[model samples]
Structures are given as structure tokens and as C-alpha cells.
Target: MPEIRNILFVMYDQLRHDYMSCAGHPTMRTPNFDRLAAKGVRFTQAYVQSPVCGASRMSYYTGRYVGSHGAAWNGYPLKVGEATMGDHLRKLGMDSWLLGKTHMTPDTEGMARLGLTRDSVIGARVAECGFDLWVREDGLNPEGPDGFYYATPSPYNEYLKSLGYPGENPWHDNANAGVDEDGSVASGWLMKNARKGANVKEEHSETPWLTDRCLDFLASPQAAERPWLAHLSYIKPHWPYIAPEPYASMYGPQDVVPANRTEAEREDPQPVYGAFMNNLIGKAFSRDEVRSEVVPAYMGLIAQCDDQFGRLLDHLESTGRMEDTMIVLTADHGDYMGDHWMGEKDLFHDCSVRVPLIIYDPRQSAGSTRGTTCDALVESIDLTATFIEAAGGEVPEHVVEGRSLMPFLRGDTPAEWRDVAISEYDYSCSVMAGKLGVAPKDAVLFMIFDGRWKMMHAEGGFRPMLFDTLNDPKELDDRGDDPACAETRARLMERLSAWSRRVSQRTTISSDQIIARRGKARSKGVYLGVYDENDLTPELLVPITGAAKGDFR
Candidate 1:
């Protein structure tokens, strides 16, 4: 097998796992995604640590669970000094660069306490989730009466203005919002304008713009100097469901898949689930006309994303870098898209939690596994471990809770892989928590999926939610409160309890390092049970006796 040198870590926001043609979307065809999948291993049951973007992406970067990292919601800063992809890769002489969204807020308070300014490289990396930036754009630069979402002017919006795009914020007005013929701005934030074409040209939209920047970086001299991990994160197929130009009109109601929900799901829904179902986003998507108008636009954005990936793949092939570079195409978290009477991601539905994961490892050893689909339970943090190993370094197991997928890539099953896939959600920031009258600390939810049954455990005294993935694939029926499933619920709850007790906080030292340092105190002259000099080995007392000619005691 040839050495894996570079990693093109690509991510699309809110891309459902089942949307790609390779993943079996009957109407929406993703030729580029299928092309990558054919040359790699596609994971059918890949799950994220969190359902929301910020928390999920932080899990991807940090290689740890949400509970371990503590960045449990959007805008919640990942603690300073948290180990990320770059932190692991740097030790192996690999550089990690960011081209798009991380949704990572800077840990200003932690940095200030440590007297580390963001201007310094170390501090800057800490602020940027351990990656040096080529162009760091989190893509949502909305401005309101309160203030701007971004502290500074967004680089993407500035690029739009330079190209003669009219408006103060072309990112919001042009790329995200649709301009009606009558000269009114139809904000994409409102799902009603989703059927209309975006105000900007196809090339000027977020997907293409970020793709062009990524190509420039890949072609640059700096990129050629060393192996690097380019996190080319595209902020598309997420919200603002507006696609520019031809992509906007590519699909319509005919191509829209029926929402996988039923009226039965609404009957006696769990309290927290009921809150989300009653929310604005949920209620809007619950209507048939809204799904007809919005899903096509959502599909169009994904189609555009696949086209952009085609450009990336072609560039790598032409440059002869495909042989050595590993490409991973995945979403931070899947969008619910009105699945199970809910819109936007949160909760444990497969539509939201199970993201599409395609990994193309350009190595001879991985050739046999190409074009195969692996059903082993994979987590978002596993990519972090895979990258560390591919970059010629071992995974810091104590820090990275996820196991590497390299074994799967090499066509081998792990001796003891995990049976359950876990995901967490922090609803303290959501309106659902307030509606439920739950305190911030108790506004949490956990999921444990063991291939057959899916169980959701909510805090604040709510009953467990259960879904039989084998029997009820669409999860229309909630077996959560069903007394018949008591044994299954208890078994899954025990798995969750075992997972929560894992050694997640002691990350600075590895288990192997601790093992090597075991019984090391004796060599350093602190033998606790030594009755006399004869009680210890002569060599072990060298630290004391071999010191200055004084009493060995």
C-alpha cells in the first residue's frame, strides 16, 4: 500500500444520508457523490455525536463526545486547548487548513484567563478549532437590529460586492434571498421563497465560491510543500434553501419525496417532542405545500454540492494527487426535512442523526474494499482517528473516544467494534426547553442505537422514546411508552449508563502512557512498602544510594 499523504476532508451541512443516489434516493441523482462512493467505502449507518451543526462539527474536530468536550450547542464555544484534528496531525508533520465553516466560536474567556491573544498563531489555532485558515467562513452572516452574526465583514459577502453585486450584504440579499421581479427581497429564511431562484449567479453562490477557494489552495505552492488536511466545508443544503441559477430550477414538486411521517406520530407525542412539533419550523414543514415548495430547493442545493465535488475530484485527478490523497465526503449532520413530523435537526431520527459518510482512501491496501458499503456502526469522531492514523501517527485513544475506520477501509472487521451508536442533544438553547419548563442543565437528550432498536433518553423526567428500525423503518410508530418493550429499553439504558462512565475527561495522557509509568515511583526512590534496603531491588534504590554519599533513607 502506498502511503496516504493528504486528506481532503469535505463536509456539506444538513445533507441527509439517503439523499444521494448511491444511498438509494430514487429521484434525486448525485452522480458525483456516486462516483466517489464507487471508488471508496460508503457507510450506511454513520451517526454523529450531536444532531445540530455546531455541536456535531465540534465532535468531528475534537474526536470526542459532546459530554466530554462540553460544546453542546450552537454558539457554545469549544473549550480552549481542546484537541482537534490539527492538534493530532501537527505532531505527524501534517498541516491542517480550513476553507469553510466550522461553526466554532472562539473561547475568548479561556484565552483571556491564559493571557493568550488571538493574534498569536497558537491562540489563533485554538480559536479556529486547531486549524490554520485559508479562508474561514461559517457562512451565516446575517445582520439584525441587535447586531451582526459575524464580528467582522464576511469575506464571502465582500467577494460578492467586489464583483458588482448590489446591496450592503450580498451574502444575505443575493446568495441566500430571492429577489422578486417586482424588486422585493424574498428572504430564504422564510421557506415560502424557496421555490424562487436565488438573487445571485450560480458561480457566485456559497458552494461554488467555496469550491473555487478550495481549488486555489490545493493548487498553491504552500499546499505542495507538505501533507495537509483541507477541511473544505460547504455551507449548503442547510437553511435558506435557495439555489442559484440553473440549480434552483433543476427540480420541482415532481422530484420531491414524500415526507416519512404519519398522523399517528402526532398522537400522544412525548412532551419534549411535542414542543418541537408545535414549534414554528415544525409546523411550517408539517404542511404538504411547504414540503412541495422546499424539498426540491433542498435537493437542488445538494445537486449543486455534488457538482462542486466533481470539480474537486477532477482537479485532484489532473494533478495526479488522487493516488496519495484521501478524500472523505460527509455531512456534519443530516437535515430532518419534515421527517417524522419534524423539520430541522434535533432528536434521534435516522433522517437527522444518520449522515452520509463516503471515504476514498487512495491506497493499494484499500482497493479491495472500494465500491463496498459497510454497515458497522461509525461515529463522526471516528474520522478524526482515521486521519491521525493515515497521517502516520497512532490515535490518542484517551483523548479520541472513537475507533479508527482504517480497519474497515483495509477490508477487515475490528475484533470488537461497538454494538451501539450514541448521539447527544443539548436543548437548553432551544425554545422547546423553555416551552417544556426544563432548566438549562436538564435540557438534554441522549440516543442509543443498536442496529435494531433506537432509544432516546430525555432529561427532566420524560419517558424514553423507542423506535424499532427493523420493523418500523420510517419510525412512524413510537414504541417509547409501550410496556411490551420494557426489556429492550432497559438493555439500551444500561448501554447508555456504561458509555457515560467512560474516561472522557482524562485526555492529556494516554492509557498506554499511564501503563508505561506504572510502578515507576520505585525507580524514582519512593517505594511505599519498603521495610528496609533489602525490601527493594538494589538498582531501584540507586536514586537514593547512588545520590550523594549520605544516608540512603
Candidate 2:
């Protein structure tokens, strides 16, 4: 057999596509990611099949829709017999290993035979997802001694704690707080452990540790022989946005903070956890400090990740693996950061759903396709198929509904890609209502983004949101009812309805004798929110009594 060239998958949890400099956001400092974009292909309209973590990742690993794999939410796991990306790679005689956080299953064995036991921590997920090396902490955030807030003082936590402003007592250090507006007082504790002299693994935080692992993988005997897939997942910039020295002081809150929201955008429905968003703005710091400072700190975290990636790239070149390897970079989902007055994802919106996707392939249809950007709609589901193709394996017939993005990446044929992207979110909001003994009135919502227009439809609510993305890029106005775009609205409704039917059917395995040989599993995709089709577009909602019996499109 020919020598196996490794593939690298770098995922940043909750990173929005538009926030990175390579994605064309002018201010964010992401030289490393931007450089990857420059050397390879950037997807302009990439989206995830589901907004939530486990579901979107399931789609990525299986190349199947969330409706196909049983893992649907953060709490869900891969159903027995479902194939993962690693499983497919292993079948092709390649050794597949998982190093970091595997939320679907807490252990490395959760998916396939590979590296390391599962710690299920954010740091570990980063290591296992793409990196061949491993050092991780699984389980929830460690509790503080006083029980007032979450803290991790494990040997790992102690190392991280050492990075904060020196205090004889770590608890007295005010780690959870942020810097004052003038950058005088400290707020929360810094997460990068090895930065200090404290004893910790080389791969820690969102950058240094992750890059170090990548370099290690490249220099090891494995790089000299076999093809490997390394995932370096970063937990920073997600929340508690506490960065250290240079990163913390690199930018000001006013310099890069997001713009204020208008009343119209704020009027939209607030997720039940409204207090978290409020606290993000001002509670962490004293008066004179608005929430804007967090942006620079967040950007600093991004820069840190970028710097680490630059180092990894240099190592790959030094090891002579750059030409033979393929690099894929993306994120599981996105964070709102105050967009729509929300902090964490689980809401259905572009801010929470669209993620940065970049693919760097050594083989090109035309030499030097640097900085090539494709606007063709792409989703995370397509990743499994792309990887399978790159690794010389046939993409299983029933694996995923997503098509390979290679055509778009090569820029040789743009006509083959999908014209629109779809997004779905499982509603924790509705579930909490039921838990609180309240009526769950809202049905789950689904969105379809055609090139020119974006339509948001909720099953329970009749209010449909239509945004002419070209005119209102911020998506501030809901024009679903505008009479001028009735035809466009009707077309989008059909598309949305058809999509629902398709995924719903594929949610389960076929009982056919042929399919049985392939060992398929039933899907556990979560459906959230409630909507009235008539309210959004009466023409599209049909008078039905039960479930959709077959494909509607």
C-alpha cells in the first residue's frame, strides 16, 4: 500500500463564521486561521445541520443528518451500531484515534478503536477531536471550596489557578471576575495553565496546548509513516472570556466590542435565560465598565488560537507533511455574545448556527488556488463524505444527504453544490417550560437560507421571519408578511416543508433487506419549537390531521 498521508481536523467550539478575520471580519485578529483561508478554500455560507453541539457533531462524524444518527443533543449519545468518521477510517486500514472531548460518548471507545480514554472535558474534546495526542479532564467544572461558583483546582486546575494574579489564597484572587474598564482591577481567573510555572500538560487552554499537541503528532513516528487525523478543539471564547496578559491587554472593550442593539432587534423573543445575557454586559465588572471589554478579550483568545495554529503549520512544513496532508478547520456551532440578547447557543439564529469552515487540500485542479472562497451553501454533514473521499474510501450510500464540497473548493464547478443551507435547533426553552409545569406552547422552528433570502419558520408560532439578507444583512427586519415578496415566500415555504419531510424520513433506518446488511440505526434527532404554517405562509401549510406520511416536496 502507498504511504498514508494524515488529515487534520481543527474544530473550535462555538465559533461564529463571521467573527474571524479570514471570514472577512475586518477587526478580529486571526492571522493563523486567516492564513489557512489564504492557502485553501473558505466556505462563505457554511452552516450546521443542527445548532446544538452533539447533534451537529454527530452529523459531521456520520455524514448523516441528525435525524439519521441517534445523538441529538448535548445529553444524547451515539446509538449502538451507528458508524462514526473514525469507524469508517478504521475500516480503510487507517488507525483512527480520538484524543479530546467526545461528548457523544464520554470515553474514546464511544466511537471506534483509537487513542486515549474519554475525559469529556472541553480541553480533552479539543485533543481527541483532531489531535493524535491526548491529555484531558472529563466531567463537569470542578466546584469551588466555598460552593459559590464552579472551579477546577484539580492538579490541572491548580496549574491554571497559578496563572492568575498571585494570591496566597487562590479563592481570594477573584478569578470569575473580569478586568475593570480601565484594565486596572482583575475579574475572572485565567485558564491557560502552562503559561505559569505550575505543573500541567503541554496542551492546555485554547491555543498553546492545542498547537503543541499538533507539533508533537507531526514529529512522532506516526507522521513518518501513517496518515492521521488530529483535532485540536478550543474551549476559549465560548464564555467566561478570561484571557491572559498579552491577549487580555491586546484590545480594548471599546475597540472591538459589538455594536449596541436597537429596540426592534431586542423586541424579538428572549430565551428563558435572559439573566445570563444581562450579566455578560455589566455584572462582572464595577461601574464604568460596560460589557464591551469582553470582545477584545474574546479576540485575544482567538488570536492565541491563531498563533498556536501558525506554529502547527510551521511544524507540519518542517516535518515535510504539508504537501501530503489535508487540513480541515471549522467549529461545532456559534455563540451569540449578546446578539439577540443571548449568550449561549440553542436558539435558532444565524449568529448561533453559522460556523467558519475552511478546507486546505494539497491537490488542486489548478495550481495555487489560494484565497479561493466559495459561496455555495455547505453544512457540517458534508464533512464525513469529504473526509471519506479524501481518505480513498467510498462515501457510504446512506451515510449522509450532504454532497462533497470538493467541487466548490476546487472552484472548477460551482453548479454542483446546494443552492441553500438549512438549520435546526432543539428547544431547551420549551423543555424547561414543561419542567416548570407550564404549557409548552411553542413548536420547534426550522430555517432555510437561500442565496438571496432567509426564511425562519416556527411550527407553533404563526409568525414567519423573512429577511432579504442582501438588504438587511443584520437580519433586523422580519418581512415574512411583506406583500412584495409573496412569491419568494411561497417558494421558501415549499423548500422548508420539503426539507422537513426528507430529514424526518431519513431519521430512521429502512427495514429493507439490502439496508439491513449495512447495519443502520434509528435516529434520535430532537425537534423543538411550535409553529403554524398558515401564519407564516398559508399557501404552504396543508390541512393535515396527523404526521407527514411521505416526502412532501
Candidate 3:
């Protein structure tokens, strides 16, 4: 019976669901995350719509599938006029604000064609992927031969320069790199440099900086005016694979278990599988030395993330903001880190597509399910619908493909729910696609997880990749060609085909409005397939017989 005053959706970049101590990580401990899970339902099975950042985040913001929104990869712009969480929450008197990275590339061309400028409110929301960005830093600003990965002279670089750090790109030179004994900069892009401590201090690092920004937002006059959905997205524990101070040396090579791979996976691999295994990033991570140097740093970054998040939680409780605020902790997706001979996410393995989803609903109904783990299938996009519902608004069925998780939070079993979870990827823009000689239009991949057997459907005539996740929990074995799995494969293929045919394009109007407007056209004096006036129903003909409706033609 308690009312929801605000929401905080926290997304950590590249955090694996299993890496959390509550989720069974042997080494990493996230006590603050554990505290949140203890007060709410922890979903053991949560899948994102895509394995990559931009596409998956678009799904989270829009509450639609990848195919529905059409922003398929990073740097790919989310088209203008999509109904996003901000649009929905704004209608319900809740403001949606962004604190950190969204990986959003504004649809500049689309906005230009529509005569929209970023200076306007509607245009600014669309430009930021439907959120009022308070501070946005993607946190990875590598300079390639062509140009920088993101805009040069970013806010983060300025902040570092303000703190007395030298150089044009302090973000890369100091924050992500270290000084060797020779006094030269060691770039962290290479795994060999990961063990070295970054030049920046822990207090000024990315995660801690973002946490400070969150505190600033909470104390701002705008946040105090009304209810808000704060998307405190952190770009950390992702790449550059370096940490500052004690965090870089906290864990060693011995702490990490061996990378999850096998020699059998290399021999006679599938076309797409072999392509990814031999790709640029893939081969680098395949080396044992690379995995050894990188995993420790990766683990340390996750530790930093845990500490920073716990810091935010402490501030919330001290300010008494946790009483009516619903908080959701999740990730865009996870990194592979040499798993399946892959360096980064692009596959459908649990290491890639699955993410941590923990929600704390500070309401009386949620108390019964507190500290409980839910094995029910959950999707990242579902948070959009859940946020809308928490704001006391109904989800627009035609627009949002994700269902609300509120029923689960209330300790009630929904009478109906989806039987399978879905994830998709468009690798046409990836170098791996070129290695396979795949056409741009045919480089898509889809994953269907039915709570047991998972099937990865590849385009361009590549056969489906199947894995018995329950029996072979590590997913090292690919049962795609096994004759015994033909039945399961066919069933999943049928399900995939059915999912493809969903009503994904009709976003302007809600299905409820359609149902409510049913049969009203004829009553408003428009008639169809009537051979004579007598053929129509008496009620329908009342308008036709009226002086206003008759013989106008």
C-alpha cells in the first residue's frame, strides 16, 4: 500500500551476473548489492535484448526489442520519435534523468530531416536517448589513427586537467595507462599493461567520479522538485582493464579460475564460431598470459564498482531517501574475458548476454518477497514497463514489448508469462563479420533460451548453435549438429519464427485504444460493405438516417 516517490536504475557496464558474491562468485563480494537484494527480489535468470552496449541500452530505455527500435549496435543512432522511458514517465509526472553513459548516438540525420534541434526540450530528450543528461561520459576515449573513439576534449578529460593532470588526453594517458620504470606511458589496451597501476588516483577514477555526480544530482534543486527516474549508468569494469592504487594489486593471477574454454571448441568449429574465435580481439584473449594479466585487473575493477555503489547506498540511507524509492541494479551486458575463446561480448553465452538484475521495492507488498531469489525468466527491457507501472501508469502494450516485473515484486505469480527469453546481435559492423565474409544484411544473430536448452540462430546460411546449458553448465559443448537435438532445434526454430512475426512496428497508438475504439467508425457515419441501408443494424443506421448524416454526398 506504500507509494513510490522516485526510482533509481543503476547499470554497471560489463558486470556478469555470476561475478557477484550473492550470485555465486567465489572471490568478488558486493555487500551493498547484497543489501539491496536482501530487501527485494533477486532475479537469478535475467537476459538482455542484445549482448552489446548501444543496442541493449536502447531496449532498456524504449522497452522494445532490438528489431523494434532498430538501433542495432554501438555508434548506431536511436531513431527520432521513439517512445522512451522518459516520454512515458513524463506523462505520469516523473522526470527521467541520466547521470553517466548511455552509449547514445543521437539520430542527427533523422532530427535534421524532421526539423528538430537539440536545443529544444523534445529534441534534447531524443538526442540523449530520452533522458535529460546531467553528466554523460562514456569513459573510453582512445585515439586511433583515423580519430578519437568519442569526442575529444570530453568533460572527464577537462576534470582531470583541472586536477593538474597534464596532456591533451589525460583520460587515456593517465586514467587508463601507467608509467613504466623507463618513465614512458604504458597503454592499458594491451593485457600486459593491465597489472600495472593507473596513473590516476582512486578518488578521481571513473566509478568514484560518477558516484560523486550522483550525489550532486540528489542534492540538486531539479531532483527535489518532483519524482525522478535517475539512470546512474556507470562506465567501468569494462575496458582499458586498469585500476588505480591498491585495487590494481588486490587480486593476483592465482585468484582467477582458468578461462572457460576447451581445445575441442577449436577443432571443426562452426563457421560463425570459428570466425569469432579467430577475430582480432578473440585471438588476443585466447592466450593464457593475456587472461592471467587481465582477469585480476578486471576483478579489481569490479571490486571498485562494488565499493562505489555501496557508497551511494550509504548516502541514500543517511538522507532518508530509501523509504519510498524503488532501486533497480542491472547491467547492459557482460564481457567474455577469454570465455569460449572470446575477448568481449558478441556471443549468446551466459557470460555475454546474461546480466545481474536486483530490484528493491520499498513497499508493503514487496516485504513478503524480500531477500528471495526468483528463478523466473527476466529481460532487461522489462524494467521500462516496471518503472512506468511503479509511477502508476499502465504500459502501452503496442509500444512496449517487455512485461512488468511488479507482480513478482509483490510476491504474486502472474497467470501468464513468456516461456522463452530472447536476445539478438547485429555483427555486420563487426570485424568478425568480415572474417566470415558475411553480407551486411545477413550478419544478424538471435538467441532463444527456454530455461534449459539454448539455441543460437545465425544468419547467412550458418546453422544454429545449440547448447545444453543445464547438463553442460559451462556451455563448452555445442550440440547444434547432434542428431538427437533435432527435435529441440526444430521447436526452438518455430518459436524464433513466431517471435519474429510479433507486432513490433505499431508504436504510435496503444492496443487498448484500438479495442476501445472498436466499431466506432460505422457509428460515426462511415459504412463499409453495405449493399443497402436496411442491411445495417438498427443502431448503426440511426446515424445514417439522421439529417446530419444522410445524403451529404
lDDT of each residue in 172-263, candidate 2, tens digit only: 23333444446543534442221212121224453564455556666667656666666555555555565555666676645654542445
Please report the TM-score between candidate 3 and the true structure: 0.96
387: Cα error in model 3, Å: 0.4
**TM-score winner, 2 or 3:** 3
> Per-residue lDDT tens digits of candidate 1, residues 346-450?
988998999999999999999999999999999999999999999988888989988899999999998999999999999998888988999998999999999
Candidates' TM-scores? 0.97, 0.74, 0.96
- TM-score, predicted candidate 1 vs. hidden true structure: 0.97
Give the per-residue lDDT of model 3 (tens digit) for 171-279.
Answer: 8999899889999999898779998999999899888888999999999999899999999998889998999978999898888877899999998888888888888
Clash count list over all predictions: 0, 38, 0
Question: Considering lDDT, where higher is better, how would the candidates rank from best to worst?
Answer: 1, 3, 2
TM-score, model 2 to reference: 0.74
lDDT of each: 0.92, 0.61, 0.91
